[model samples]
Target chain A: MYRVKVYVTLKPSLLDAQGKVVKGAAVNLGYDEVENVRIGKFIELSINENTKDVNTAVEELCSKLLANTVIENYKYEIEKE
Target chain B: MYRVKVYVTLKPSLLDAQGKVVKGAAVNLGYDEVENVRIGKFIELSINENTKDVNTAVEELCSKLLANTVIENYKYEIEKE
Candidate 1:
């Protein structure tokens, strides 16, 4: 099997409202050193080893279902299992 | 400055409904090689270098705000930027 770890994050150009809220809360909680924050999604997938072209399959999954390419960018790492 | 990357994931014992749904969708889309899927959150925080202890502050943030320790587990990496 192959283990794929994907990270989907919003483009730097876009505003991350959720991260902003978290940063505000962090500051309120007295973490005055916080400067900026960004939030993203992390997905892990287990795939059968027999699948042809594991890399391509994972790329398709990320672009088609895992990430909203218009606003978010995704990258993944594959490891043998 | 310091860049902290945090990943919050549901405990392995918990059911991941969202990931299950996505796996089903992937199958429907013809990527049957998928065996299992799990989803989590990835957060990035930029902190000032002057912070007394970046590690402790991030640990507190994860346990107190970023993660539901009862159901989720979190880990982080810190890099000087």
Candidate 2:
């Protein structure tokens, strides 16, 4: 089996409202040193042995559905298990 | 400065409905070898220099807001920058 780890994060240019709230909460909680708090999605996909050309396949999958290219960026790593 | 990477995932006992949907979609797209897909959250907390006891601070943050211990498990690492 194989495990694919995908991390989807917002583009730097976009304003992260969720992150801003977290930062505010952090400061309220007395962690005044906290700065940027970026929230994103992490996805794990397990693939069995039958798949072929896994890299290209995953690339297509991510680009087609898992991530939005216009506002978010995604990076992935595959591990054999 | 420090960068903290946190990964929050559902407990093994919980049903990952979104993941299941993705797996079904993958199969429909001809990637029949795909098995399990687990969806989770990735958070980045950037901290500046004034904070003390960062490890404990992050743990507290994770427990209080970043993750729901009842159904989610979180692991984190800090990198000095």
Candidate 3:
């Protein structure tokens, strides 16, 4: 099997409200050193060994279902299992 | 500055309803090669270079705010930036 790990993150130009909130909370909790924060999604998919073209399949999956292309960017790494 | 990347994932023993839903959708969308699907969170934090004991601070942050110890596990990597 192939284990595919995908990370979907907001576009660099966009403001990350959730990250801002978390950073604010962290400072309030006394973590003054903490600075800029960004939040994203991590997805793991297990693909069968016999599957052909794992790269193409995963790319399609990410563009179609795993990420919102307009506002986010996604990247994936595949590892043998 | 130190760039910290944190990944928070549900415990292996827990039922991930969101993952199940996504897996089902993938199957429905004809990505039959796809198997197990799991979802998690990815957080990036920047810490001042002057911060002392980054490891300890990050550990405390993970346990206290970034992750729910009862049902989730978190791991992080730090890099100089």
Candidate 4:
């Protein structure tokens, strides 16, 4: 079995209202030293088959549907245990 | 130093149109075995200060802003290296 993890984040040039809210909360909670809180997405997928093409398949998955190239960027990693 | 990773995901009962799109791509790519591709978010933050209050601070951050309690759920793990 394999576990695939994907992270999705808004483009750096875009305004992340959600991250702004978190930054505010961090400051209020005394994490005044923390900066740049950008909120994004994470996905974990479990695959039963062990195929050599999994990585490419997943990369295609990200480019095609899991991420929006115009506004968001995605990075993924796969692990086997 | 401390690294905090946060994961956010839509509630299972909620509709995941993004996941649906990924599922379609998987099918097209011959991943006929792939199923139920729900997407979420992951955040990594670095803290230079080693304080006992960090976890509480992070929890407060999550409750206050890092996650939307209404439609999303969040889980975070902290690591020091």
Q: Largest lDDT belongs to which candidate?
A: 1
Deviating ranges (above 4 Å) for candidate 3? none
Residue ranges of candidate 1 with Cα displaced over 4 Å: none
Instruction: Give lDDT tens digits, candidate 1, residues A1-81.
Output: 999999999999999999999999999999989999999999999999999899999999999999999999999999997
TM-score for each model: 0.99, 0.95, 0.98, 0.69
Interface RMSD of each: 0.6, 1.2, 0.6, 2.9
**What CA RMSD would you report for each candidate?**
0.5, 1.2, 0.6, 3.7
Q: Ten-residue segment with the worst summed lDDT in candidate 2 chain B?
A: B47-56
Please provide, for model 4 over A1-81, each residue's C-alpha lDDT reduced to its tens digit, 9 standing for 90 to 100.
777888888898999898777677677877885665777778766665656688887787778767788999988898875
Give the TM-score of chain A, superposed on the true chain A, for all candidates in the order listed: 0.98, 0.95, 0.97, 0.83
TM-score of chain A taken by itself, candidate 1: 0.98
> What is the Cα-based TM-score of model 1?
0.99
Residue pairs of candidate 1 with colliding backbone atoms: none
Q: Write the per-residue lDDT of candidate 1 for residues B4-79, one digit (tens) a residue.
A: 9999999999999999999999999999999999999999999999998888999999999999999999999999
- Between candidates 2 and 3, the TM-score winner: 3
lDDT of 3 by residue, B1-81 (tens): 999999999999999999999999999999999999999999999999999899999999999989999999999999988
TM-scores for chain B, listed for all candidates: 0.98, 0.96, 0.97, 0.89
DockQ for each candidate?
0.91, 0.82, 0.90, 0.42
For model 4, state the Cα shift of residue A46 in Å: 3.5
lDDT, ranked from best to worst:
1, 3, 2, 4
Model 4 alpha-carbon drift over 4 Å, by segment = A11-17, A28-33, A48-52, A69-73, B10-18, B28-31, B46-52, B68-73, B79-81
lDDT of 4 by residue, B1-81 (tens): 777888878898998898887777777877875666788877766655656687887787677767788998989998876
